[model samples]
Target chain A: MIAVAQPTTAWYLILAALLFSIGTVGVMVRRNPLVMFMCIELMLNAVNLSFVALARDLGDIKGQTTVFFVMVVAAAEVVVGLGIIVAILRRRPNATADDMAELKG
Target chain B: MELFVFVLASAMILGGAVGVIVRNHPVHSALSLVLTLFGVAVMFVSLEAHFLAAVQVIVYAGAIVVLFLFVIMLLGVDQSENLMVEPIPVQRPLALIVGVGLAGVLVTAIVQARSAVQTGTGAGLDNATQTGDHDSNVRQIARSLFSDYVFAFELVSVLLVVAVVGTVLLSRRPARLPDDIGATR
Candidate 1:
């Protein structure tokens, strides 16, 4: 890997794909809701990386603009999700996702 | 130079992502998330999306991860979770298969479309020219955000406010407000 070649868009895209896959696996394998949320964040970041890469590749600003919106949405998501988790855990300490099957309060 | 930075940042990203999943303690996972966020920010810099990179660090690493840590402490669920227990015997294996299949499909699609992509198509992205426009990237993003996506930008503000209010409601204890109102009545 000592070559003086610059990494291409393909390289970045491949990396993003791998990252997204890892996140998916984490979401499925982890029972802890908080950790699962973090994995979702990982997947979001993966998509953001690809968006920026493609923006650079196509010389378009739209990709960056979309990423801006994504970041906002992600923040909102994490807040609301953690809030629900807190509420659930407050009622039943050490509650995992499997324990919260019923939506009733 | 660019190659070196790309390689290093990729390493940071993948390593942190793995750490987030494998770590037993929630706090450790949160810290690992921070590492991945920083790496993504670095990648944004390399891609010349400087403003997004800054926002990424501030919002994701600074605020979001802090919120995660705070929740961890508040809930005291920071204790190590048992990773060995398999509630569903075949779930992990199935998840691994799904992840690998998804990656394969994505990579194949990207490689297949690699040649069809037309580069430098959209009024080339603004970069700092030899002339004094060092903030070209920021300026272009602002122009786009305020002009074309302004409505969507405003909607985001609404979404954020709703999120804040909803979270407050969700986390709030189910006080006997209704009964209190009835009593007062």
Candidate 2:
């Protein structure tokens, strides 16, 4: 069992997969939009981990480069998404995603 | 040295993640998530990805989790009062089966890949003999970012700016609350 410690890069990828899936479940189970957003970030982070691991394995900088792009998009997502949530909350104090099911006022 | 660090960090990170999911209170979960993020950062460091480790702590634990806690407080969500008393639905069984199946697949994939790596597997491993100007993993990363895929870098920066503006618009509310729907005129 001690031999299990030295994981190949594939282990990291699998770990990333697990993390992303957990985030997906979090999004499904958690009712709060804020929590959902956090879960989404968790999913994005898992991908970053995958990119770094694979890049190292391939002996190339390409994966990390892709990760950088993903990071940028993630940053933007948080800024915009959280801002929108706050705005919605401001308008309707308890603005949950579950509550906003209607198409029209 | 490597073996010790990996084992300890992985155990801690995995445990923290479990704690976060098991805890019912949002505050407890958030705090456990912090531990998870920190543990993940340590794992990143072990993987020779220092930059990512830093980002993991600052972005995930420092900023993101803090923002989450703030929201929880602001919303004043009372799980005790607001908790759904519905019976154990189909979701519980489904979630369990899916989660366990994914874990099994992952463990199998990992075991397979470990047996497949060729010699001198990772670039991050430091060799004292290769002492030249280009000696660090960070330097290698910088070289790649500037040399190739530079266009993607610039696009991401633009995305950040757009996100900032969009967030403002999305969160903003009218200065005054109009009680009547027709009062906006």
lDDT of 1 by residue, A10-48 (tens): 999999999999999999999999999999999999999
Q: Could you tell me which 10 consecutive residues in candidate 2 chain B have the lowest summed lDDT?
A: B78-87
lDDT (10s digit) by residue, model 1, range B71-92: 9999888889988888999999
lDDT of each: 0.91, 0.66
List, residue by residue over A1-105, the lDDT tens digit for candidate 2. Answer: 455457667767777777767776666666667666766776787778777777667665566667766766776677766665665555566666777677443
Question: Candidate 2: global Cα-lDDT?
Answer: 0.66
Using TM-score as the measure, the top candidate is: 1
DockQ of each model vs. true complex: 0.65, 0.40
Off by over 4 Å in 1: A1-3, B129-131, B177-185
Please give the lDDT score at residue B82 for candidate 1.
Answer: 84
